[model samples]
Target: MNSHTAFVAAMIAAGMFVLLLGTFYFGNFRRQKPALWRYVADIDRAGAMIRRKEYDEAEALLAPLASKSDAPLHIYQLRAAIAQHKGDWVVAARHWKAARRYFPDDALGFAGGARVLLRAGRRAEAVRMLEGARSRVHNPSQLTKVLAEAAQSAGDWAEGARLWEQVRNEAAGDIDSYVRGHDCLLAAGRPDEAAAVLADGAMRFPRDPQIVRAVAAAAPPGAPGPA
Candidate 1:
């Protein structure tokens, strides 16, 4: 080939390579830059503040970021956590609600809301929130126990008994269920049933003082205590 023709071909090849490289670089930059730069800066700053135990300032910074319509769910979650740490229950609830709006099926948001309600002494509301969280929670036993305790506080013995039974069943080998079940039975005025439950528990856990005492307490006036 002639030198001129070879040079022209080489220039064309270099130009195509440059164009391809520019296209890929700019495309990657355009796709990643705004998300990485815009989203991460505030998130990282907020995280740093949280790590430094400056929850209020972290939350203040996160709030505007989280308020954006397109803000990430995690951002809202962080804001909620910050609000909770700062004892701002109302704001925490609002942030959690916003997080839930973005991810309706999020277990953490529901659980967090329930915890806030419980802390705020809104037992009935907490129970309702936990009921909604039941399907979403991987392990609802803790929340169920809290709900049962709330019921007990409200003097709803029947609901408390049912919930305690559920917790006892979930706990399986744990003695807490037996204790709670015994107390619940006694509280519900079913002493005979309580005696039976305690007797059975004493047989299974012979060394448990609570079980022994429960059996004794539930027995009829002339009934013998556990041997």
Candidate 2:
């Protein structure tokens, strides 16, 4: 063909070559989304194993995903649960901590760690772990009492009082809050506050034998009820 026709053909060929080269380079050089579907499915299988109480097998399945950058956060959680099942508190504690480390903003991680600490009898640490996590904790009403008890156990009576009051408000007529709050105040050498809690309990629950007994039991000789 003529010079112009030949030049046009060369240009078309060059364009096609460039297009194919980029496609091949990207296909090989650039990492594609790793196929995480199988990892997710395996994680689910591990969960089933945990439910069946086959901790060893569950752990084996979870080992691969535990440190995988793209793995779901539940992998470490399941690992922690398995460790807890096996009664390895140390391992469980670290795994729970790792879960939180991987997801700083995740409530599940903090809750998991706090739960493990509670089970390990590290009451003070558990309460401290829960301090920042209380708002994010699941089932706040139930957890409020747990954290309050932990605070009381740790002798942080002010924190204990606050947590118990939170539970009392959320639970709406749970006598345990008033009773336990009174006990915590006594532990902290605050008899006046203790009496006030008991008096409140008696006011709210006039017929509750437990509150009446507590207030009477706490009253000084001949001082009358909750004066």
Candidate 3:
């Protein structure tokens, strides 16, 4: 071939190579960016992986998307939970704390953070954090049980009873919670209060065996029946 024709063909070949390379590496000429959709799909799979207790795989899938500005709030939640599954309470608490800012009205962050601390044997800090979280929480009913346990951890039987009372009120048929409340009151050396709770239970659920049994069990030897 002539030198001029050969030079022209070489230029065309180089241009074609650049076009294919851009399309392959950068997803050129596609709708939005392919990576964005892939990120979303990765997150969904990661959540399922987390549920399956594949923490390492879930974390690997989430790591790249976690740094995205528009990353889902559950990314941090899952990270914290993954850490929790691995028994790394410190890392779990840190991620849960970060997630808390995104979920100002939800108790997941506060509850998870406090629970990890409690499990890690930091009762004082856990209770303190849980106390602060109480006001910020929007759905008290949803967290009644969580708060009750935290109160028990803090050795605040009165608070535990109060939260269990909240639970009982929210779920009127929740005899289990009322029983727990009585137990907490008894633990605080208030047998009278314990009997009172059972008595109230019997009044509310006249036919429930739970209330009948609890009332019988809560009484002290030779003590008058609950008022």
Candidates in order have lDDT scores of 0.74, 0.78, 0.76
TM-scores, all candidates, are 0.47, 0.49, 0.55
Q: Among these predicted structures, which one has the highest TM-score?
A: 3
Candidate number with the higher lDDT (1 or 2)? 2
In model 2, residue pairs whose N, Cα or C atoms come closer than 3 Å (at least 3 residues apart or on different chains), thus clashing, are none
Instruction: Candidate 1: list runs displaced more than 4 Å.
Output: 1-116, 209-213, 216-227
For residues 150-177, what per-residue lDDT tens digits would candidate 1 score against the true structure?
Answer: 7776788777778888887776555666
Scored by lDDT, the top model is 2
Q: On residues 100-154, what C-alpha lDDT tens digit does candidate 2 reach at each position?
A: 6655555667777777788778877876777766666454565567787777777
Per-residue lDDT, model 1, residue 156, is 80
lDDT of 3 at 209: 77
